[model samples]
Target: MAFLESVFAVIGDLTWGWALIPILVVLGIFITALTGFAQFRFFRRMFRVLWPGNQSGDPNAISAREALLVSVGGRVGGGNIAGVAVAITLGGPGAVFWMWAIALVGMATSLVECSLAQLFKRREPDGMFRGGPARSIIHGLGADYMWLAMLYAVCLIAAFAIGFNAFQGNTVAGAAQDSLGIDRIWTGAVLTVVAGFIVFGGIHRIAKAADIVVPVMAVAYLAMTVVVILLNITAVPEVLSSIVLNAFGLEEAVGGGMGAALAQGLRRGLFSNEAGLGSAPNVAATADVRHPISQGITQSLSVFIDTILICSCTAFVILLGGVYVPGAEAIDGVVLTQQSLAWHLGDWTQYFLTFILLLFAFSSIIYNYYLGENALSVLTESSVARNALRVIVMGIVFLGAVAPDATSVFFFSDPLMGVLALVNLIAIMMLLPTCLRILRDFRQQLAAGVARPVLNPEDFPDFDLDRTAWTGIDPDRR
Candidate 1:
C-alpha cells in the first residue's frame, strides 16, 4: 500500500506540476485570444441564452436550462466548499485572487471545448444526445485518431466514474460522521440506495434531478454567504485587499509565497470549475441549442458561478470569521469552512453545513456517473454492459462512503484526469480553426438581426460535421 501511494504521489506531482498546469494556462490564453475573448464579448449573451423557458423542443434533447443545471451539478461540488477552504489554508487569502484569474481565462477554454462537444454530438437510439472529447476527437479529427479517443474514454472512466465518485462519497460520509454522529456504514448504505436509484434511470433522470437541486442549493448557499458578509461587512474590504496582496508575494502571512498561492489557486480552481479539463464538455454536449456556441456561451457562465461566485463565497466565509490561521496545519477542507461558519453563525451552523455538503457531494456523484457512462458508450454499445457498469458505480459509492483510505483514491484519480486533460487540450488546439469559424459565423448571424444564431454545416465544407444533428436549422430561412 505504501509503495502504491508513493508511486501515485510521484506520478501526480509530475503530471500536474510539470505538465498540466503550464499547458492549461498557455492553452487557455491561446483560446482566449483566438475567440476574441468571446467569454467577455458574449458575457451578456450567456445569461440571455440561460433565460428560463429556452427549450429546443426536442423531447429526447434536454432543455438548455436542464443542460446548464447538469453542468453546474458537475462543476459546483465539494470543490467549491472543501476545495476552496483548503486553498486558503495552504495558499493564504491571496489564493482567491489566483482562482479568479484562472476562471476569467478559463471561460474562453470552456467555450471552445463545449462548443466542439455540441457540434460533434451524436443522437443515441434513445434520442438523447451523447458527445464529449471522444466523440469530438473522432468526428472532428477523423477516424484515424480513434485510438486517442478511446484512450481518453478509458481515462475518464478511471478518473471520474470509479475514482472520483469514491472520493466524493468518502467526503460526504466523513462530513456526516463528523457533524451528525452518524456511522460511516449507515451513511454508505443510505447513499448507495439513493444514488443507485437515480443513476440507474440514466441521463434524463440525472438531468431532471440536477435541474431541481443545483439551483436551490446554489441560491441557498449564496444567500447564506450574503448574510455572513452583511454581518461582517467591515472586514470585506480588508479581506479583498489581503487576497490581492497575498497573490503577489506582498503578504508575509502566505506560506511558501506566491508560488504556493498560484499552484493551489490554479489547481483548486481547475478542479472546481473544470474549465479546460474536458470533463464539463461531456455534459455540455447534452444540451439542446440553436447554435453550438450558444451552449458554449452558457457553459462559460458555469465557470463563473463555480469559482467566482461559489468558491468566493467559501473564501469570504473563512476569511471574515477569522477562523483561518495561516501557516496552521490543523485547519483545512470542509472542516475549515464549517468551523469558520460556526464562529459567525453559531454552533448550529455545523449541522446546516453538513446537510449542504451532502447535497453538494451527492449532486457531484450523479454528474460523475454520467461522465463514466459516456466513456462506456464509446467502448461498448450493449445495454447490459452499461447497466452492469452502473451497478459497479453504485458499489463504488458505497465503498467510498465506508472506506477509511481516501488518499489512495485521490492519488489515483489525479493523474488519470491529468492525462485526460492533456489529450483534450491537444485535440482542442488542433480544432481551433473550426472553433474560430463557428464563433465568427454565430457573430455574423447575430449582427444580421437573427434572434438566436443557428448552425449551418454547409458553411464549412472543408470540415467533417454531422449534418443530421444540425438539420434543426430551418431550410427556408437559410
Candidate 2:
C-alpha cells in the first residue's frame, strides 16, 4: 500500500504543478472580470430561483431546487469538515483565508463549467437530461477530444468513486468507532448496505436524499460551529490575525513559512469544493433548467456554500477553539477537528463531529457513484454494464472502509483530479466566449421582462436545451 501510494504521489506531483494554481486563478479572475462579477449580482436572484417553491417547471427536467439540491449534495460532504480540519492543522489557521479566496474564484470556475455542460447537455434515451465533459468535449472540441474526455471520466470514477470513497468510508467508520466504540467492520458493512440502496435508485433518488440531508446536516454542523466560535469569541481576533499574517509569508506571527500555509489552504480548498475538478458539472448537467446559465448560477452558489460556508465554518471552529498548535504532533483530519470541538464543548463534541462525518461520508459515496454513472453513461447505454459498475462501486466502498493508509488514497486520487481539472478547465477556457454570451443573453431577456428566461434551442447555435423530442428545435417539442 505504501509503495503504491508513493508511486501515485509521484504521479500526482508530476501532473499537478504550482503553475496550474496561478493559471486557474487567472482564469477565474478573467471570467469574473469579463462577466462583471455576475456572481455578486446574481447571487440574490439565484437564491430566489433555486430556493424551494420557486423551481420552474419543465417536461423532463428537475425543479431548480432539485438541481441545486443535487449540486449541493455533491459539494457539501465530509470534505467540508474533515478536509478543512486537515488544512488548518497542517497549513496553519491562516490557511482559512486562502481557502476562502479559492472559493470566491472557484464560483466563477464552476459557472463556466456548468454553463458549458448546459450548453451541450443531451437528453438520454431514458428521457432524462444528460450532459457533462463528454457532451461538452464532443460538442465544443469535436470527437477528437472524445477520447481525452472519456479518459478523464474514467480517471474521475477511480479517483472520486474508488479513491475518495475509501477515504470517506474510513473517516466515517473510524470516527464512529472511536466515538461510540462501534466496530469498524460493522460500520463499513452497514454503510455498504445504505450506499447500495441509494445507488440502485439512480440520480433522482440520490438528489432527493441529498435534498433532505444536505441542508439539514449543513445547518446542524454550522450551528455547532457557531456555538463553538461564540464561546471562544475572545480568541477570534488572534485567529483572524494568524490567518492574515500567514497568508502573506509572515512566518514570525504564523509560526510556519508561507509555503505550508498556501499549500495547505489550496489543497484542502481544492479537495473540499472541487472547483476545477469537474465533478459537480455532471450533476449540474442532470438538472432540468430552461437555460444552462440558470443552472450555472445555481451551481455557482453551491461552490460558495461548499468551500466558503461549510469548509470555512469548520476552519473557524478549529482555529477559534485554539486547539491548533502549529507543528504539533501528528493528528488526522477529523480527529484534530474533534479534539478542537471537544476543547470547547467537552465530550459531546466528539459525537457531534461523528454524526456530521457519517452524514457527510454517506452523501459523498452517493455523489461519487453519480459521477461514475454519468461517465459510464457517456460511453455506453447498457443497463447491465451500469449494474456491474454499481457492484464495483459497492465493493470499493467496503474496501475503502477497511483500508488504513491515508496517503495512498489521496495520492491516487490527486493526480486524477489534476487531470480532470486540466481537461475541464481547458474546455471551460475554450467555451468562455459562449458562456459569457449566454449570460448576456439571459440578462438581456431578464431586462426585457422575460420573467422566466427559457431559450429556444433552434435559436441557440451551440446545442439543444430540450430534454424530450429535442430535434434541436425549442417550441416544436414544448
Candidate 3:
C-alpha cells in the first residue's frame, strides 16, 4: 500500500505539478483573452438565462435551468467541503488565495468548452441530448479526431465515475464515523442504495434530483457559514490577511511556501470547480436551449457557486473557528471540516455537517455516474454495458467507503483526475476555432437585439452538425 501511494503520488505530481498546472493556467488566460472574456462580460446574462421566464411543457426535456442545477450539483460536492479542508491542511491559508485565482481563470475556460459541447451535441434515442469533449472532438474537429475523442471518453469514465466517486464515498464515510459513530460499511451501503435509485433512473431523474437537492444544500450550508462568519466577524480581517500574506510567503507559516500553495490550489481548485477539466460540459451539453452559449454562460456561474461561494464558505469556517493548525502534517480531510463547524456552532452542528456532506456526496455521485454514462454512450450505446458500469460504480463506492482512510482514496483520485483532465484540455485546444466561432455568433445575436439567441443549423453551413437536435428549437420559447 505504501509503495502504491508513492507511485500514484509520482504520477500525480508529474501530471499536475509539471504539466497540467502550467497548461491549464496559460490556456485559461489565452482562452479568456480570445473570447474577449465572455465569462465576465456576460456575467449579468448568466443569471437571466439561469431561470427561464417559464418552464417548457415537456418535463422530460432538460432545460437550461435544470442543466445549471445539475452542473452546480456536481461542482459543489465533497470537493468544496472536504477537498477545501484538505487544501488548507496541506497548502495552508495561502492555498485559499490560489484556489480563488484558479477559479477566476477556470470560469472563462468553462465558458468555451461548454459552449462547444452545446454546439456539437447529438440527440439520444430517448430524444434527450448528449455531448462533451468526446462528441465535440469527433464532430467539430473532423472524423480524423475520433481517436482522441474516444480516448477522452475513456479517461473521463475512469476519473469521474470511479476515481472521484470513490473519493466522495471515502469522505462521507469518514465524516459519518468521526462525528456520528456510524460505521463506514453502513454509510457505504446507504449511499450505494440511494445513489442506485437515481443512477438507474436516467438523466431527467438525476436532473430533477439535482434541482431539488443542490439549491437547498447550498443555501443551508451558506446560511450556516454566514452565521459562523458573523460570530467571528471581528477576526475576519485577520483571516483575510493570512490568506493574502501566506499566499505570497510574506508571513512565516506552513504550506511549505508559494510553490506548494500554487500546486495544491490549482489541483484542488480544479477538482472543486471543474472549470477547465471538461466534466461540466457533459451536463451543459444536455441543456435544451436554442443557443449553445446559454449553457456555457450558465455553467460559468456554477464555477463561481462552487469555488467562489461554497468552497470559500468552508475555508472561512475552518479559518475563523481556529480549528485548523497551519503547517501541520497535512493529513486532515472531511473530519477537520466537521470539527471546525462543531467548534463554531456546537457539537450538534457536526451532525448537521454530516447530513450536508451526505447531500453533497450523493448529488455528486449521481453527477459522476451521468458523466460515465455519457462517455459510455459514445463508445457503445449498449444497455448491458451501462448496467454493468452501474454495478462497478456501486462496488467501488463500497470499497472506497471501507478503505482505511482518506489519504489512500486521494492517492488514486487526485492524479487519475489530472490525467483525465489533461486529455480534455488537449481537445479544448483543438476545438478552439469552433468555440470562438460559437461565441462570436452568440454575441452578434445579442447585439442585434435578440433577447434569446437560438442556433439555426442553416447558420453553421460550414460545419457538420447534429441537426435533429437543433432543427426545431424555438427562438422565443423557454
Comparing 1 with 3 on lDDT, the higher-scoring candidate is 1
| Ordered list by TM-score, greatest first | 1, 3, 2
Q: Write the per-residue lDDT of candidate 3 for residues 3-75, one digit (tens) a residue.
A: 9889988988898768987898999999989989888898888787555573444677998889889989998
Steric collisions counted per model: 0, 1, 0
TM-score each candidate: 0.96, 0.92, 0.93
Best by TM-score: 1
Which pairs clash in the backbone of model 1?
Answer: none
* Model 2 misplacement above 4 A: 1-7, 58-60, 250-256, 405-411, 462-478
Whole-model alpha-carbon lDDT for candidate 1: 0.88
Model 1 residue 362 CA deviation in Å: 1.1
Writing each residue's lDDT as its tens digit, candidate 2 over 286-343 gives 7776777888888888888888778877888777765677778758877778888888
lDDT of 1 by residue, 138-248 (tens): 999999999999999999998999998998889889999988999999998988899889999998999999988898889989998889999999989999998988999
Off by more than 4 A, model 3: 1-11, 52-57, 328-331, 403-413, 472-478
Overlapping backbone residue pairs in candidate 1 total: 0
**Two-way TM-score contest, 2 vs 3, winner:** 3
Worst 10 residues of 2 by lDDT: 469-478
